[model samples]
Target chain A: MKVIETINLSKIFEGVVPVHAVNQVNLSIEDNEFTAIVGPSGSGKTTLLNMIGGLDRPTSGTIKVNQIALNELSENELINFRLKHIGFVFQSYNLIPVLSAKENAEFVMLLQNIPAKDRIARVEALLKEVGLEDKMNNRPSQLSGGQQQRVAVARALASKPDFVLADEPTANLDSKSAENLLDIMHRLNKEEGITFVFSTHDQRVIDRARRVITLEDGKIISDVIQHEN
Target chain B: MIFKVAWRNIWRHKVRSTVVFIAIALGLWAGLFTSAFTHGMMNQKIDSVIKMEMSHFQIHKPGFREELQVKLLMNDGENIVQAIQEEKEVIGVSGRIVTMAMLGSANKNGSVRLNGINPDDESIVTGINEKLVEGEYFRGVERNPILISRKIAEKYKVKIKSKVVLTMQDMEGNIVAGAFKVVGLFDTQNGMYDELNVFVRRDDMARLLGVGNSLHEIAVLLGRHDMAESMADKYQHVYPKLEVLPWMDLSTGMRMMIEMMDTYTFIIVGIILVALLFSIVNTMLMAVLERVKEIGMLMSIGMSKTRVFMMIVVETICLTFLGAPLGILLSYGSISYFGTHGINLGDAAYADMGFSNVIYPSLEYMDYLVVSMMVIIMAVLAAIYPAIKALRLKPVEAIRKI
Candidate 1:
């Protein structure tokens, strides 16, 4: 089943010289795929990801997640849809600095108005899955770079979304932390059958993905599969 | 959960938030303190007017106040004083034979109101007996004893036991002369009243003027000063032949002065609250601006605009509330202490203006609640700009900001 589909998506930044941040891109992700979108600087990989994640409106296109068109939703309805369906992991690990790890993980579910008992149970399980069970009570400021990223991952998955869109998840982590993070995400992907998509320039992320889509400028140049990974 | 987030967010920058807290605290303190001080000063003047000059209210025959004619006396004035003293709200009452007389001393002479009163009865209405600086209250003299103010004594070059002659008109329109000895020197602290009046035994003045038991003025003091106007109106209805006036009406510009001072007090408080409102707005705006990326991230992850806007408002209100209670407590503590102990002006300047030098600051419990409600309203008003700023943020553009 296709979880996310974007048809002819384009984002234009208008000025004296117009910049097409993402131009005429058509993309689809299956329900349980581990995919990576890789490109160099100014390649529109993050822009494409933002449009697909419902974080930005397309200059011209339609985005369907779970068969509902994003363009049809109002601004407020889009926020509610994002709350229910999209799990976002930013490059900077944007966990609320004031909340403890468990609180941050359960925040989206709380926004969804999930009952306290179910929210706690699912948040705890997700934290443990991301190897953060011991650090559940710690704030983001108290956690290291890799540890914060793992908590972000737990937060994203805690909502039980169809897929997680991560933008440079390991960009700020050291090599060893990055490897540890990738290992955890790979395990979660394979074991729980959760779909994951990432936009990155990191070679390590590209090597580990089941499929890789490479972009040049604002257009995709290649979509290749590495089944062994 | 939103409240929890907002409360935690306030502490993220402890020094910034603490600065806001202290501003609210000190600003409210100053505002309330100044208001209480103004109230105290004005109330002191009111007490002086009621106690020393007018005695809450006064009564005279219809034409006597406008023209100090001896023939315009209240024939039933003594009966009226006794009747007023029987009222439940009446604390004291006194009747006097009031006439303008040429008071002549060996050294000088001046025109003054010769207030002829029964010394014992007058003492009940006005506490003049307690205000004597030298000599006694109508004592140390045998015949026709008189009480004079310090200003009168100084101007006449007279002292206690000095003989002065009063020349005044009788009810028969005859100019009569009588000799009186000063027995006491008193200072009412109201320079105008002090300079214009002298007191003598009512029997002495009436005897010399050839009148019996007839009086020109009846003064009545009430238990509560606020009831003066209504009681005066009631008495005016009951005694239609006489004119009754409250203390406010008896003094020139008294009503305007009270209203002006009240307006000035509110202006002082209003200025302080406006200043506090700006301080909160600026600080909360800074807080919102500093957290753009975080706010954008929260919205991107599905926090509604309403929720985000409310978060800023809640944070601002929480910050304001933190200081409001402290400010109120400080105000209550200081006002409570000073209300009894009094704040001395350290000079007789206030007294010369007919106000007490030592002022006891006070506020009703309701004023605090009203001021608190004002602060809460100010906090919410102060929150609007920053909260709206947060709501206007676009997640895409905002998340890109550092």
Candidate 2:
């Protein structure tokens, strides 16, 4: 089942000399699959992920996420769709530095207007699942890089989003911390059937992803599916 | 949760938040202090006028104020006084006779208005006992005593108990003369009042002017000075033919001057507030720039633009609401203490502003409340530009931001 599909998608920054960031590309992401898009700097991997996640508009193509034409939706409707269906994690572990681990995890549910009682339970359950229940009240600054990423993953899954989009999630982490965070994400994907498409350059993250796509200079060069060991 | 986030965000950059809080507090304190100072100065001036010239309320014949002569006397002063006395707010009422007269010494000379009042009644209206500089207020009207202003006494070389001659028109329209011993001296603290007013027993003038059956004007004091307007309204209704003037309307020129001062104050304060607003806006815009990635993360996590906008505004509102009122409270304390002790500007300094001696920076409670509201409003409005910038931010670019 295709959870995300892009047909001839491209992104160009209009200037005196128009710069093409993402060249025409077609891709499909399977439901509950862990996919990694890896490329060197300036390869347009982030832009392609952004288009698929409804965060950016493709210059000339259709992006169908769960069979819905995202480009056709109004701005407000797109916001609603993102809120209800998509989750996001960032390279910086963008866990709202102001909030504690628990609060950051519950942010999406709060945006969903979920009742406080249910929101609390879901937040606690996700925090426990991420093995950060002891750090529930600790802010991102207080948590280790690995713990913060775990919190970000818990936050992404809080509202039961159909899929999660992570942009270089382990780019700012140490080797050990990156391995710990990737292990948590892999366990979550297997146990909860949550689809994830991440953009990264780290070989460790690529090794953990079930499918890997390689890109160079804004164009995809290879797509390979690794059999589960 | 948004409020919680906003509250926590303020503490994240403790030094910056503290500086913003202090800036807002200082702005509020300055605004409230100035507002309170204006209120106090205006009130002190008004009270000085009430104590020196008009009491809380004054009544006259229909055309008496215009003519200000013996001919404009109210024939039924006793009856009107009786009717006005029925109101509980009326503290004291006095019937008076006033005439423009020439006052002179052996060498120097000046013109003044001679006001004749029932001595016992006049004391209640003007606090004559408190204002006496020398000699004493007359006990009864039959003795025909007069109180000369201190400035007039010094200029004319008139001593207490010295006889002075006053020349004025009689009720029959002929120039008349009357002699009276100076029984008391007073300083009303207003240069105009001290130079141009003479007080005497009412019967003396009534006999000299030959208007024994009438009175020039009626002055009434009320329980509270602020109740003057409502009491004047009642007086106007009761005696439609007469002019019922409150102390404020009686001194229209001075009130207008004070009001003009208020307008000038508003203009200056308005400029400062605008500058302060821009400062706050610039600060919040900087926060937006620094937190671009954070905002993008919030939006990507399904926070709507409206919610982001609200969160920013709510944070501003909370900061201002907390800080501004504290500043106002500080202002209130400073003004209240100084208002009573009165930092003296000295006679020469006071005279520069055309005031008599001292300036009291007084403030009413309402003034503080108004300034608090205004500062808060400025702060909330200041948040708009930054909030709109945050709201319209595209999540993709914001997340990609450095």
Candidate 3:
């Protein structure tokens, strides 16, 4: 089953001169598939990711997630839909600065109105899986860059969304921290069958993706699949 | 959880939060203290006027007050006094023969309103005996002895036992003149009243004016001045022929002063809170602007716009809650202490204003509650603009904000 399908997705930024940020992009993301949307600067990868996560409305497009038409929903309805079915990770490691790692992980489920006992159990399990169990009580500022990203991943999965959309999730980390983050994400994908769609130019992320789509000037240039992990 | 996050968020910028907290606390303290001081001054003025000038209520023949003529004396003075004293609320009563006359000494002459009283009854009604600053109150003095204020003595260059002559029209239209000695000098701390009034024996004044056993005014003191209006109404109903007036009617200027004190206090405090409202809005706006990205992150994670708005409002309210109670406590302690010890505004300053030098600050319990509630309300009003500002940020754009 496809988790998200976008047909003829386009976004135009109107200014002194119009710029087509995302043009006629067609994509289907299947359940439990780890994919990467890779591109150079100005290629509209972030714009595409934002649309898929319901963070932005398309100039003209139809987005169906779990067979529900995204374009037909109001802005408020789109927020509710995103809350129930989609999770996002930004490159800046945007963990709430005042919240501990455990609380940050539990935040999405809290918004979901999950029972406190179940929320605590799931948060503990996810933090342990991401190798942040011991650092659960530390605020975002007290954690390392890699640890914060791992907490972000745990937060994204806490809502039990159909897929997680990450925009350059490893761009701000050191090489070793970037590698550790990728390993954690890969392990979670393999063990838990959680799907991920990331927008990145990082070679380390590209090397680890099972399928990669490359874009240039808002158009897909190549679509390739790797047989090796 | 939203409250917990908001509470922690305020402390993240300790200096900013502390600045707002201190501003609110100090603003409330200043407003309450100033209001209490104003209430104190008004209370002092009211008490002075009631005690030395107009006892709670006064009764008079209808035309006497308008004309100040000796002929307008009450026909049955003894019966009116007996009726007033029978009222359950009345604590003291006195009858007086009041007439406008000119007082002359060897060196100077001045116009005065002379009040003739039986010294013992007058003491119970106005406590005039206690205000005597020199010589004896009409006690142990010979016939035609009088009491004049120290202001009168200084102006006329007269002293105790100095002989002064009073000149007035008799009830039969004769211009009568009588010689009297100044037996006592009284200072009532009311410069205007002191300079205009002189107290003499009622018997002596009646004899000189040739109106035997007749009186112009009956003053009644009540157990509580707050009961004055009701008592005055009752007296007016019973003595329809006589004019019954409460202190508020007898002195319109002082009554207006008391009423204006309440209104002006509210207006002044309202202005202060409005100024505080702007300051609070500015601070909270800065907090919201600085946390744009974080706010975006929360909204993207499905914290509803309503929740986001409430978080900011709750944060502002929490800040006020932290500061207001402390301000109230501090103001209460200071007002209580000063109320007992009294704030002396110097003799000259008070004398010029026709009040006593010492003022005791006062506040009702409700004032503290009202002021604190006003601060909280101002904080809530202050939060609205900032909260709406937070809601206007689109997640995509806000997440991109540096």
**Which interface RMSD values do the candidates have, in the order shown?**
0.6, 0.9, 0.8
Cα RMSD, each candidate: 2.3, 3.4, 1.9
Report the lDDT tens digits of candidate 3 across residue range A1-229.
9998999999999999998988998888888878999999999999888888888988998888998888888878887888889888899989999999999999889888999999999999999998998999999999999999999999999999999999999999999999998998888788888899999999999999999988887877888887444
Return the top candidate by lDDT: 1
Name the TM-score of candidate 3. 0.96
DockQ of 1: 0.83
Give the docking tier of candidate 1.
high
Model 2 lDDT at residue A69: 93
iRMSD, model 2, in Å: 0.9
Tens-digit lDDT track of model 1 for B1-402: 889999999999999889989999999999899889988888878888888878889999887887898888888888888888889999899898999999999999889999999888789889889989989998877789999999899999999889999999887888999999999999877777788889999999999887799988999989998899999999999999889999999886789899998999999999999999999999999999999999999999999998998899999999999999999999999999999999988766676677777889988788898999999999999999999999899997788898
Q: Which stretches in model 2 have alpha-carbon errors above 4 Å?
A: A115-121, A128-131, B56-89, B139-144, B169-179, B206-214, B222-249, B254-275, B335-345, B348-369
lDDT of 1 by residue, A55-172 (tens): 8889998889999999888999989988888888899999999999999999999999999999999999999988999999999999999999999999988888889999999999
**Candidate 2 lDDT for residue B68:** 81
**Largest TM-score belongs to which candidate?**
3
Badly placed stretches (over 4 Å) of model 1 are B66-71, B101-111, B151-157, B165-179, B207-212
